[model samples]
Target: MSGYCGASALNRFVNDLLFFRNRLPLHVAEFSSYGGDNFDEAVQYLELWIRYSLSCPVAKLSVTSHDKYQRWLLPKGLITSEHLTALQLTRVKTQDDLDFSSCVSLKHLKMTDCGIYCDRIMSPSLKRLMIAQCHFIGYARTQIYASNLILLLLVDCMGMTPLLVSMPYLVEAFIRLGYCNDFCKHSYEIGDCGDESCWGCQFYEDNYGNNNCILLHGLSSCTNLELTAATAPFIFRKDLTRCPVFSKLKTLLLNEWCITNNLGALICFLQHSPVLEKLIIQFEPPEIHERLVEIGGSYDLRKQSLVLKDLNVEVRCDDGDERVHKVLDVLGSYGLSPEKFKIQRPPKLTRARFDDTWTSGSFSFEQEI
Candidate 1:
């Protein structure tokens, strides 16, 4: 029942359910706050249901707090359940005493707007983890060790310290990390002090030396990778010391933000991936492109022969410029047919942009008239 229950009635219900919960064949139990007057009563009943589910053979447990004012603190004992395979929590907050290492059977974990205070999450059986709009609680860096993980998605998460991951079987990953207000000081230091004729921003230089080394190592096995504009700067700002090999990667999607700003990272990917087939780069906002031109590249990826086949480049420019042609020439040097590399200018002057698709087949290179 997803309706309101009085305090006394809820207590009685839990007492009654306790007698037969062991005998009932419970596979899934979902609880959502529909409507209720007594808040404590509702919380007690929800806690009781969670406890019951943890004690049985329940495979899935989902709890949602649709009301903005309603936030639930996840019970610490919830992770101790040996049978839970899937857990979905919305608007949930975790405390320091929580331990997720005991969730050995957990395969899928989805958290939205959650505050994670734990320092480490070690799950051997976890396969998919999706976290969106969530924030870390303390100053500790988040460490995750999942050997069998296949898919990982992190979107718009904030307050993230250095992240360390060790996943050997990861196949598909999408990481979109946007600028948060908390890192404003670091941004100002880099933007104001490090200008034209400056060596570089010390703040970003320190972050590069720490963040990407381990994170990129974890993502080396992905077959399809998408890095939005937000996470592009991490690679753009640094000259990688040790690059990971993307042996299985076939498809890669990059925002024009990365190409315009951190072309070296793109070059690094090309050098590492031995069998990359498709590359799609989307046009970013004008402001972002301008910033890249200002302080983007002082260093570039080392030249190496690559096995890339298909290239799709999207650009926002007034007309075909020398800079754009230079990029095409670079790719051509890598063995892509310049004839098949045709740029399609928009019919009307709507935006400063064009799309070019290059397929590695025997075709004539057509030039713009």
Candidate 2:
């Protein structure tokens, strides 16, 4: 398997997985984007990979097709439209949709900037999902319902939440809501075009990062959850739940400044997610609040059920008294031995921003917190 014949043989090996796969595995699985006078040749390549490579034990899908990349621009029937001008996509074809239902054994799916969740798709074997800057994602029933699935990320999908897919048993989910201020134009461009048919900014905005809000609604259902956000404003209302859930969660991350009574949120967290063991509190510069030592001597967590094992902290500067000891007092009260603490004053903050009206002094902690 050397040149073009090697590619062809690999394609054949991948196209029909039932044809004795698990031999020497073809390392890279790619979706060709060559939209020429002869488009069938490319579809043959995609169909082969989607059909074959996915059948193995350690399947890898790095979807970068002209179709997959631009799947966001194509509507229900317009992907195959004969009228070329009617579409905003660069490649036009009769290629059938590529899904992962057959790839139930897949462990890794990397679709960066793709048109995913367009159908009732699921990857029961998926363990990793990485999606970057993509377009419209049609709401599939459940793109990932696998119990084995872990680690999933969606970045820069400016306009839509193409990620409403729910996983009942995920252990780690890291999501950043919203996008760069520059990409805001892309959101407005793909807006709903039907004023007479009922469409507006909000309707169209429902497509990208806005849809990441789906994670909030799906959180209570995720008992085995450990998630981190770069300061998302999705403060779930009281009716959402009195206590936050993460019963099996062991590690929590904070990339920027985190402000609260610190204890109030902890009260709610311990009230529900009792099994938590490791808590990481990271702070950015200027507001690192210094590091908490044995502040206020010690304070109790109020709820006595929490048994946290570790508190690994990274602070930007060693400056303020308000920052350090307050948190230490909170942990000391929780019965955490001093030897279990892993604290680092980084002297600099990571490039992240957080907005806590309670912490920023716009509102008083006694009032809001």
Candidate 3:
């Protein structure tokens, strides 16, 4: 139902749904509501509808609120559903401490453009979890516990990157941290930032002790993984010291952040992934005075062991040849032969074209080291 409908109409719709009490085992249920003249009443009706639908034992449920000014709290019943297998929430505000352990049968869960005010998300049966364009509003970092998760996509998420608990079955994951994330607010290079007052640095030091693995250890089992961030985030760089050996990883994709600090992070991954086959690097235009800022300690690439079958590098700037040469020089030092890699450059570069390169895989091979 559209938010344009008045409260009376909404109440009528709920009444109609209540009238059809025989409709048990609902295959799918979707509800949308934006701010209306009677906002509070609309919310009440929406909650009522949600509660009634849960009683029908919905297999799949999707709730979306288009009102940007306010976010509707998810009904408690939705969180504790036994029949819900798939759930998608958009523009909704979760409670202060959101937990989904009660969703025993839920397999797929996706949240987009939502406010996450919780400190942890715990689920046992979830196989696929995707959170995109969401804001995590809590002061402490959110921990994700989805032991059975096989696929995870966390794209453009803001506010302290969530810590991933071990998911031994995870096969694929794509994490792209946005510019508004907490780590991006700091100016100094991650890990090396000596500012005593910087919370970002302190948070990393305190949270990432010898035993704590912020991301890499949990993601070690994934066969295919993509790690991208706007303005180099600290989690990836900090986790490098304790980065678990990606024994199962075959394909890996990294962005400019990996090479920010003299290609140390890039080389570290190569050294760790013994059986890695294909590696793709997406290089953005370099700033005029953007010198390589050292974040992680340098690795001796001469001791590298992993031999990649194919390495694709796509440069998004016109003066990419020089940069590409520099990159090859570094890799060459690490014993990666010229024939193992290919370079691609589009005639006209745009963000859309750059993003499409991942799926298209159509390279001219005009520039090969």
Q: Best by TM-score, which number? A: 3
Full ranking by TM-score: 3, 1, 2
TM-score of each: 0.72, 0.50, 0.84
Predicted candidate 1 versus true structure: per-residue lDDT over 1-369, tens digit per residue: 454354556456666866765657668877664445655555656676777777776888888654566567777666667788888887777765444567788888888887776766567888887777777743445666677988877667666443546677997776666653223223322133444433323333433323345357777888877665464354322323356778888777665544543355566667877777666554434454533432423334555656445654433343544446655766776677765455544223232111122121201111221
Query: 104, model 1: CA deviation in Å?
Result: 2.9
| lDDT (0 to 1) per candidate | 0.59, 0.40, 0.70
**Evaluation by TM-score, superior candidate among 1 and 2:** 1
Worst 10 residues of 2 by lDDT: 79-88
Give per-residue lDDT, candidate 3, residue 4.
Answer: 34
Error of 1 at 181 (Å): 7.0
lDDT of 3 by residue, 1-369 (tens): 555367668667666867776656678888876456655665766776777777887888888875747878875435678888988888888765666777789998888889887877888899888888888853678888899998887878777778888889998788777754556234554444676777776676665323476788779898888887776556777677556888888778776677754677788777888878777776655653243355434545555565544444343444544667767888877677787757764244333211212321333111231
**Model 2, CA-based lDDT:** 0.40
Between candidates 2 and 3, the TM-score winner: 3
Worst 10 residues of 1 by lDDT: 358-367
CA shift of 54, model 1, Å: 2.0
- Candidate 3 is scored at a TM of 0.84
